[model samples]
Target: MATVDRSTLAGRRDAAALLLGYACAARVSELVALDIADVRETPEGLLVTIYRRKIKTFTEVAVPYGRIPASCPVRAVRDLLAAMAEAGHTSGPLLVRITRHGHIAPPLTRGGKQIGDPHGRMTAEACAEIVGRIAAAAGLEGRWTGHSLRRGFATAARRAGATLERIGRHGGWKDGSTALLGYLEEGDRWTDNPVTGL
Candidate 1:
C-alpha cells in the first residue's frame, strides 16, 4: 500500500520518481539518467528517449497520459528543467547530486560548469532507500523498491480496468506477455492479495 502522496518536498520528489518510473516503465537506472532534452511533449502524451548502457540501445518510448497537464509527468520534467536553470545547468547528465546530508543538488563539471549529475540517478540502492523513506513518511508498511513503482503502475492500471495490451505498449514491452509477467509477478503479488491492498 505504498502509494505516492505529493504534498511534502520529499514526497513530491518521490512521487515524481515513481510517476516517471511507471510512465516510462523504465529501469531505475534509466529513469535516473534521463536528461531534460530526452523528454518532449507529444500530441499523444509524452515521448521519452531512453539510453541504457547494458542494453546498448537507444529507445524512443511514448507515455500516453491525456496531454501535458499540471499533474502529469511533463510537469515533473518542467520542474526539473527549472531547477537546472536555476542552478545554471545547461547540459551533461540529469539526475544531479544526492548529498550525504540528504539534500539534492546539481552537479558541476570539472571546469565548474553547471552539469546534471548522473550519479544521483535512481540506482537500486537509492531506489530502495527512497521507497523506504516514502513508505515511512506515508505511514505505510511493506517491502518496496524502484521496481515497485513500475509494478504498481501496471498492477493498479490493470485493476482499474486498463487493457493488458495498452499497458504493455505504454510500458514499452516487446509483448503483452512480458508486460503481463511483470505486472502479475511484481504487481499482483501486492495488490491482489487479500490483505494490505492499496
Candidate 2:
C-alpha cells in the first residue's frame, strides 16, 4: 500500500481498492461490484456493503480506523473518493479503468454488434491483473492475485488474536468452514509451534 503513489488518481484508486478489499476481507467479485454509494463513512470508520453473488444477498462489513495512519483503509478510501470527485466521478463504480493518458475510460457500447459485457465497470479479471501489476511494481516475488488480499486478511486477523467466529463473520465464511480453519492454522504455524525450542 505504501508503494502506491498518492499523487496520482490511478494510484490512489489502486491503493484504496486493495486496502478496502483487504480490510473488509472481500472477494474480488464483491470488491469490483462496489459502487460509490455502497461505501459509507461512519464516525468509527467505514460501513461497506458487499454483494455476495453466490448467496444472492448483501453483507455489511465494518472497517475501523487502523493504528497505523499510513496503512489505514479508511484514509485510503477517503482519499480515493476525494480524488474521484475532483475528476467528476462522484458516482458510478468505485473502481474503473484509467487510460494510459490518465483519464477514466468511457462506458462500453455495442454499436450494432453483440457484446457480452456492456458495462463500463472493471471486471474481476482486470482487478486481479491490477493486483499482479502492483505486486510486480513493488518488486515482490510471489504469485499475488486479488484473492491474496482476502487470504492475507484472514491470516492477519488470526495472528492479531481475532477469534475464529469474528474472522469468519468478517470474511463472510460459513461457520465451521474447513477453508477458514486452514487459513487460521496457517497463520498459527510460525507462532508457538510444537517443534519450537525442542
Whole-model Cα lDDT of every candidate shown, in order: 0.62, 0.84
How much is the lDDT of residue 35 in candidate 1? 70
Q: Point out where model 2 deviates above 4 Å.
A: 109-119, 185-190, 194-198
Clashes of each: 1, 0
How much is 14 displaced in model 1, in angstroms?
3.6
Give the alpha carbon lDDT tens digit for every residue of 51-168 in model 1: 7444467777776663545447656655655655655765654555545443555344667665544344445567557756766776877777767766777777777777888776
Which runs of model 1 end up more than 4 angstroms from their true locations? 1-13, 43-45, 52-57, 64-71, 100-122, 176-179, 185-198
Clash list (residue pairs), candidate 2: none
Which number leads on lDDT?
Answer: 2
